[model samples]
Target: MLEIFPVYITPFEQERLIRVYLPKNYNKENKRYPVLYMHDGQNVFRDNDAIGGKSLELENYLDEIGLEVIVVGIDQNSEDRKNEYCPWVSGEYSKKILGYTSSEGGKGTEYIDFIVNELKPFIDNKYLTLKDRTAMAGISLGGLISTFAACRYPHIFTRVAAVSSAFYRNQEELEKLLKSSDLSSIEDFYLDCGTKEASGEALISKEFVASNNSIYEILREKISNVKFEIINDAEHNYFFFRERFPKILSFLVSAK
Candidate 1:
């Protein structure tokens, strides 16, 4: 089942669409299900709503696997992608991380606050959810924010996924933040990217993908349950992410 509603992001002073997915038997069953909060709501379910009309087909896949986790897809503001996705100042970050000129950013924390304090409460109140079985996952800058949320507020988001995160921008800041974070409450953490994204002179020079791999290693060393992966011949795109969605969900919706 699918439900769409408007969520007002108070920090950004904007309203966005939030798509919620429930199992077919949700109304009939009394069991509370685990929830996976995903970023880029538009690209999550329907191809009509995705970039290049490439939907994740998540519902079908979950059904095929007989998994019943609730999925909440949260939309993002495309115009301020860099600003809202960045958890730190862009200048202090690498210069060409955005594939363009340098930028001035650092509003990610504020964006996360809205998700944690506002949207979460709404979802929790509306759905029969397993409060302790909550996770946050996203792609690109969305991935960056998901990882940030996991680090900053593990009590609220116990599991996290940074799928092809935009790490090139704030590598140092991210490393410092994760190293200093309180992740005692986090249970499962997942970090991954396609081989194509990790390749090339741009991402292999100890700054982009290599550094991301290092971050995964660091997190795995520091945290109890962490998984890192590299997809063979995959690229940074919606189709690839859609294909990986099932595996990602499988990792997250474990014994909880």
Candidate 2:
């Protein structure tokens, strides 16, 4: 069953809906489960709520695998997604990607603070969770934010999966932030995308292949375990993430 509730993101002063996907018999079961916090809640489940796309079908995936874990999906505010997902940088990138000017986006650190301080404490107190077994993940721009979250609160989130991250948009600034972060406590990272993500006819605002590769290299240099890959036929869409969700979950849950 999915538990839904309204959460106030104090930093943004906005109330976002968060959905929790609990395992079968959660109320009857006595076991505590590891938690996976995901961004873009609308697309995480419920096909009807998907923003012009299909749902990830996450509930079915979990049932088929028989892996009982808690998934907390945090919905994003559309108006501030760009601003909040953009990594906290020193404003080096010219506020532009594919000719579109990005907002100052320096507020991402504050956004992460909201999740770490406000949302996480609430979830931990309300649910039966394995305190240390936690991960944060996202796709595209949300992916960018997840990467930042893992770094900003390495002690809070031990694992991270940033799929097809829009790193190319704020490459320079984001790299600076990653390089300066303390990743000593982070357990693992799954960073990947498709080579075609950078192609001409692929319809992406910016090709993020090289940027993600750079993120992998930078992370590997500082952190011991970092998994990077370029899927053969993947794209910048939910289908790629949905197809790869099983492997992603396995890696993340194993880290616990």
Candidate 3:
């Protein structure tokens, strides 16, 4: 059986959903499993909330396959999502397209702190978890946040799975940070993007391809335990993410 917990984050007064999937043979007396903190909580488990029934269907599939682990889904506040996702904003994308005020920036760091310091402790205290082995996963803007957290707090998150990361201007900044930081002991990292036109508004455009390639190239050079996959015909949407969740989960759990 799965356990669903609705947690309220104090910083933004946000109610996030935490979905916990227990293995069919889960025995509290026998084993402890790793935890995966995923972004866009509303779209991760079921289609009932935001995606209009186009959710990833991850919980159902993982439960059916009996891959037991705790999945915490952090839902984003749509209005402040871009500010919370993008680490660094350049040009007018933040204001013109994303609709963010100039003063309401740098929330990504706070979001990360809330996760690593606040939410993790709360969950660890309440559930059976392997604290030392933790991972963060997300798609699109959420993917950008995951990568930023992994890079900034390498010690906190041992694994990062970013699907179709929205590099934008932050991509270059992350590359520079990774180049300057000591990443020898960092944990596993996974990145995947699709080539289809429908994958994402940014991915389908030719301009963003260079940014994505640059980010991948830099990670390849600096991070040792990393995997990069470019899906030829896939697009940026919940459907594609659903298809890829099993593979991502398999890789993440294998490290445990």
Candidate 4:
């Protein structure tokens, strides 16, 4: 079953829609389940509500597989998405690669703080959740934030999946942070990037994949259970992300 409600984000000082997907037997049974918090709430489920008329179609997939886990999708602020998802301001190279004249970012710390400090507590109190068994997943910039959150709060997000992660902007900084932080609590991690993240630019696509690999290397050193995959022929979009969801979830579920 799916449920949508507005929740106040104290960091942003506004309420955004939170999409929750409960197990089919959530109401029928009295079992507590692990929760997976995802970014880009609108694009996590139904396609009709997605920005580009595409979504992960996660609801159908989870229901079809009978995965008894809770999913919480936090909507993004379209205008401030870059800032909220990036822990530091975009670097010069990032702007050059993305063709942006201005700079945006540096608010991610506050955003993640809201999730760990306020929103998570609210969700745990309202639902029958296995508070200790929490995970986080996201795509693109969303993936970037998920990785940052894991490094920042490893105890809270034990399992993390970062698909088609765009880490060009803060690659060096994130690598440093991940190395310095204590990631002993992280149980499972899934990181991947497509061979063709950018259409028609082989060099750029290779660089994108390489950047993700750099982070994967750091994670492998700290995390006991980590999976890094280079998806062949995949692109950076919901379609490809949806295609890889099963593998991502499977690893998260089975990895010991």
Candidate 5:
């Protein structure tokens, strides 16, 4: 079942919608399950509430498979999305991607702070959760922040998934950080990008795929259990993310 409620985000000093997914048998058994925190709350569940009327429909997938886990979908502030999703200011490549200079970034640390320090504790206390078996997942810019969270607090997030990640936004800084950070605490990581992500048309963007590949190369050395894939014919949208959600979710929950 899915439950929706408004919660105050202390770091942003704003109230946001949080979508929680409880297992079908949550009330029937005394089982404590792992927790998976996801970004883009609106697009993580039902389609009616999603942006552009498209979503991952994660509730259906989880319920169909009978996966017993708690999913917390944190809503995004549309106006401050870029700022909250990027850990640093727009890099050169990011500027080029938009065909102009943009300075909407650098608040990602605060957003993550709220999740790690405030949100996680609240979820743990309110639900019967396996506190140690926590994971995170996101898409596009959301993917960028999930990766940053894993590196910043490796001990807190044991598994992570980034699909169609716009790592180019902070590629240079992230690559440097990944090379130096200790990722030994991350037990499983699933990273993937589509060949048709740039324009979402027939034309393929080698540059986009290369940006994700570079991060994968760095992670393979730092993380012992990392998986990377270049999905064929996929684009940067909820439709494609939904198609690949099963694989990503499977990888994360498999080991845990």
Candidate 6:
């Protein structure tokens, strides 16, 4: 049985929904399963939160596929989302779009800390989880944040699934992090984007694709366990991401 709970994260100053889908074969007698932490909680399962009436239907699809991994979705605050997604605020593009006055902007580090220190510990205590076999994933801006978390805190998460990541801001900083950071600890990293996403008013720009491809190319060179996919005839929206959710879930679980 799948249990959906509303968790109040004090550090983020918001109440986010956390949905856990327990497979039918889940047993206390057996070993614990891995966990995948996903962002954009509202758009993951239902259509009401997406553009059209068609939803991702992730839970139903995963259930049919007989995957036994637990999924935790964290909702993003619309106003603070951009700031929380990007790592550094000193970049020109970040300052223009995010409107951060100070050189150090965005509470991304704090948000990740909240997830790693507060939320993960609580979930670990409450559920049967394989601590080492953990992953983080998201789409668009959320995808950007997931990638940042993976690069910054490689010890906390072993796998990452960044779908259509918005990498318009702080390209040099991200490159520095990738170069200096210890990526050898990362087990798996997945990057995917739609070709048609280039033409959209979805807050995506040329810089976005450039940065995304740059990061993808760099990761391909540095990380051995990295996978990249580009979906054709697809745009930057929930529909495309919904279609790709199954593949992402399969990849995450199969890596275990």
TM-score winner between 4 and 6, please give it. Answer: 4
Off by over 4 Å in 1: 91-93, 96-101, 198-207
Each candidate's lDDT (Cα)?
0.81, 0.80, 0.74, 0.89, 0.90, 0.75
Q: Write the per-residue lDDT of candidate 4 for residues 1-256, one digit (tens) a residue.
A: 8999999988788999999999888999988998999999999989998989999898999899988789999999999999999999887657656767447889999999999999899999999999999999989998899999998999999999998999887776788899899999999999999999997888889889988999999999999988888989898888888887987877765524
lDDT of 6: 0.75
For 1-256, candidate 5 gives per-residue lDDT tens digits of 9989888988888999999999999999998989999999999989999999999998998899988789999998999999999999988887656668888899999999999998899999989999999999999998899999999999989899988899989988998889989999999999999888975544336677888899899988988899999988787877888998987888888753
Q: Kindly indicate the candidate among 1 and 3 with the higher lDDT.
A: 1
Candidate order by decreasing TM-score: 5, 4, 1, 2, 6, 3
> How does model 2 score by TM-score?
0.91
Model 6 TM-score relative to the real fold: 0.87
The TM-scores, one per candidate, come to: 0.92, 0.91, 0.86, 0.96, 0.96, 0.87
Residue pairs in clash, model 6? none
How well is each residue in 1-256 modelled by candidate 1, as lDDT tens digits?
Answer: 8899998899888899999999888899899999999988888888888867887878677666768889999876778777888888754446655455565569989988988899888999999998878899888778888888888888978888888887767777888888988788888888887777644644543345675686897788677999888777767788788877778888888884
Judged by whole-model lDDT over C-alpha atoms, candidate 2 comes out at: 0.80
Write candidate 6's Cα lDDT for 93-195 as tens digits. Answer: 5555445644643677878888898888877888788888889988887777887898878987888998988765666677778777777788889998776
Model 3, range 101-126, lDDT digits (tens) per residue? 35543678888988888999987887
What lDDT would candidate 4 get against the real structure? 0.89
Provide the lDDT at 45 for model 1. 80
